[model samples]
Target: MMRNFHRWVGLVLSLVLFVAALSGTALSVVNVLEAGRAIRPASTQTVADLAARVQVAHPGLEQIRRAPSGQVSAWWFDGGQPGSAVVDPATGRDFSSADPDPVRRWFTEVHRSFFLGDSGRIVAASGAFAMLLLAVSGTILAVRRLGGWKRWIARLRGPLAGRLHTEIARVAVVGLVLSAVTALWMSAETFEILSIDEASIGAAPSPSGRTGFPLREMEALRALPASSLRELSFPAADDPQDVYVLKTDRGVGYVDQGSGKLLGWQGLGFWQRVSETVYMLHTAQGAPVLGIFLGAMALGAAVLSATGVLVWLAGWRNRPRIPANAPAARADTVVMVGSENGSTWGFAATLASALRSAGHRVHVAPMSAFHPSRYPHAQRYLILAATYGDGDAPSSAKGFLGRLGELRVPPSAPVAVLGFGDRGFPSFCGYAHDVDAQIRAIGWR
Candidate 1:
C-alpha cells in the first residue's frame, strides 16, 4: 500500500515538483555566485557612519539597503532621475550597478510563483507540500526495502533504475525535506496565512521643527553595526515632519530628522523572526555553502523523480496476467506470489500452468491476499516470494507477515516455500527466508 501510494502520488505530481526543484536549484546556484561576488563590509563599521558617508557622496540619497550577502546598496535621485548603485560601506563609493541580474530575477519569479501571481503561488505551495509527502513516504519505503533502519546503507542489488532511485533518495531526502518544509513555511508567510506581525514603528513623532542634525549624531543609528542594518530611508527632502526610517535585523524604528532621537520602536515578533529565518534558509541568501548543498539535492530530486516514474512503468509492463485460474475455495493447490517488479508473478503463472496440466485445480494470487482459511479445499500451498532491497519483503507481500501472525490456527494443508533473488546481494532471498521461518514458527507443515 505504501509503495502504491508513493508511486501514484509521484506520477501525478512529478511534473510540477520537477519544475519547482529545477528552478530552485538554479536559483540556489545563482545565490552562491552572488555571495561569492558580494562585498563584505568591515566588522567595525556602523550604520550611522555608512549613512553619513552615503549622504555626503550623494546629497540626493534616498535609501540605503544592506543585502543578506553584506552588500550595501544606495538609491538616489540625480537631476530628477532615480539611480541606484552598489556602494562601499566604508567610503560610500559606487562600485557596481544595483540593477538585478535578469536571469536571476527570472529564476526567482519562476521559483516563487511560476509568474502566475496568486494562482501560481497556490500551485507552488502544493508542489512543496507534495515534495514533503514524497520525501516522508519515500523514506519509510526505503527503510522497509533495506529491511530496517540499521541496514539503510547496505549493498543494493536490483535493476539500475531501482538502485539509482534508492541511492539518490537515501542521500538527498533530508535536504529535500528541509527545502520543502522551508518553502511551505515561506509560502504560508507570503500568503499571510502564518500571521506574522508586520514590523511597524507606529506613527512617527512630528519631527522637531529644527533641521540640520547630522545622521552620524543619531544615537540609535550609531548603536547599530553595519551587519545589523537591513535598510534606512532618509527623511524626505524639505519636509520638517519627515523622520529617518531605520530597519534592522532586530526591529524597526523612526529617528527624528532634526533631534536624531528615536521616536518609536517595534521589535520583531517571534513569528516574524521565524518567517525571516525560513526565508533565509529557503533562499540561501546568507549562506552559500548551504545553498550549494541544497542545489545538489534539488538536482537529485529531479533525477529521483524521473527514475521513480521509470521504475513504476517497468513494473507495470512486467506484471503477468494469469488465465484460467481456479477460485480459492475450489482449488486443490494455492499459489501465492510476492513480488516488487512482478517477476515472481511470472514464476507463479508457470507453476500454476504446470499444476493445471497435471489436472490439479490451482488458484494463483498475491501473498498480500493470503487467506488459507478461505481455501477450504486446498491440499497444499505453494509460496513463490521474491526478496526486495536488502532482504526486505517485496511490495506485494508487505502485509503477508502481519496477516500470517494474525492467524489463530495454522492451516492443515502442507506448504512449501520457493525463494527468488540474485545472489549478488548480501541478503539474497532474505524475505523468503523470513517467511519460511515465520510459517515454521506457526507450525505449518
Candidate 2:
C-alpha cells in the first residue's frame, strides 16, 4: 500500500520536484559564488567603526545591512537622491551595486514560489511534502530490501532502473529529507501556519531632544562587533524623537541618538531562533559547503523521478495479470508468490493457469497474505519465492515467515516450494528453502 502511494505521488510530483531541484541547485551555486566574492569584515571590527567610515563617504547615511553571505550594503541620500551599494567592509566604501543579479533573482522566484505568488508557494510546499514522504517511504522500503540498515551499502541486484533508483536514494536520502523537512517548516512559517513569537523591543524609544551625537561614539554600536551585525538604521535627520534601530544576530535594540544609550533591547524568542536556524539550514545561506552538498542531493530527485517511472512501467510490462483466480476457501490449489519486482508473479500466473487447465481450482496470492485457516478447502500449496539480499524475504514475502512461525499447526495438506533466483548469488533461493524447512519443521507433509 505504501509502495503504491510512494510510487504514484512521486510520479505525479516529479516534474515539480525536478524544476524546483534544478533551481535550488543553481541557487546553491550562486550562494557559493556570492560567498567567495563577499568582502568579509575583520572579526574585531565594530559596527561603530564601519558606520563611522561609511558616514565619511556618505554623511547622510541612512542604513547598513549585512547578508548571511557576509556581504555588506549601505543606503544613503546624496544630493537629495537616495542611493544604495554593496559596501566594502574593509574600507567602508561602495564596492558594487546592491541590486541582486537578475538571473539569480529569477531562479529564486522559481524555486521559492514558481512565479505564482501565494499559490505558487503552496505548490512548492506541496512538492516539498511529497519529497519528504518519498524520502521516508523509500528509505524504509530500501532498508527492507537490503535486509537491514547495516547492509545499506550492500551490493544490489535487479533491473537497471531499480538498481539506479535504490543506489541514488541510498546516497542522497539524508540530504533530500533534510531539505524537504526544512522546506516544509519554512513554508509553514511563510503561510503563517507556525506562530513564531518574536520578542518585541517595543516601539522605538523616544530619542533625546538633542541630536548630532557622533555614530562612532554611540555606546551600543561601539559595543557590537561587526560580525554580529544584521542591520543598523540611522535615525532620521529631521526627527529628534527617532532613535537608531540596531538589529544583530543576538537581538534588536533601540539606541538614543543624542544620549548614545541602549534604551531598549529584545533578545530573540526561542521560536524565532528556531525559525532562523531552519531558514539557514534550508537556504544554506551561511553554509556554502552544506549548500553545495544539498544541491547535489537535489539533483537526485530528478533522476529518481525518471527512474521510478521507468521501474513502474517496466513492472507493468513484465507482470502478467492473473485470470480466473479462485477464492482461498473454494480452491483446491493455492499458489503463494513472494517476488521482489513481480517476476515471480509471472511464474505463479503461468502455474495457476496450467493447474486450472488440469481441471483444478487454484487461487493466487502474495505470500504475505498467507493464512492457513483461510485456505480450509485447499488440497495442496505451491510456494514460489525469490530470495532477496543475503536471504532476506522478497517484497511480497515480507512477514510470511513470521506468520508461518505463529501457526500452532500446519494445514492438513501437502506443500511444495519452488525457488527463483540467480545461481550466481550466494544466497540464491535461500528464502524458498527457509519456507520449505519451516513447513516441514511444523510437521506439514
Write down the TM-score of every candidate: 0.86, 0.82
Q: Which one is best on lDDT?
A: 1
The parts of candidate 1 lying over 4 Å away from their true place are 90-93, 321-335, 349-364, 369-381, 390-392, 398-415, 422-430, 437-445
Q: Compared with the true structure, what per-residue lDDT tens digits does model 1 show for residues 1-445?
A: 7777888889998888888889989998998998999886789988889999988889899999999988899999989999899998878989899999899999889988889999999999998898999999999988877768887887777789988999999999999999999988988878888777779967896668667788898888888899999999987768888888999999999988888888899999888888888888888898999999999999999898899888988888787788999988899999999998877888898999999999999999989899877899999999999988668888888789999998889999999999998785667788899999999999989
Model 1 TM-score, 2 decimals: 0.86
lDDT score for residue 82 of model 2 = 92
CA RMSD for every model? 3.3, 4.1
Q: How many clashing pairs per prediction, in order?
A: 0, 0
Per-residue accuracy of model 2 over 1-445 as CA lDDT, tens digit each: 6766888899899889889988988888889889889898899999989889888988889999999999999999989999999989878889999988998999999999999999999999999999999999999878866767887888887789999999999999999999999999999988889978666677876667778888789898899899899999998878898888899998898988888899999999888898899999888987889888988898887789889888878877766878998978899999998986778888999899899999999999989999998988899999998887557787788789888889898888999999987664556778888998898788888
Looking at model 1, the pairs that clash are none
| Residues forming the 10-long window of minimal summed lDDT in candidate 1 | 201-210
Provide the lDDT at 148 for model 1: 81
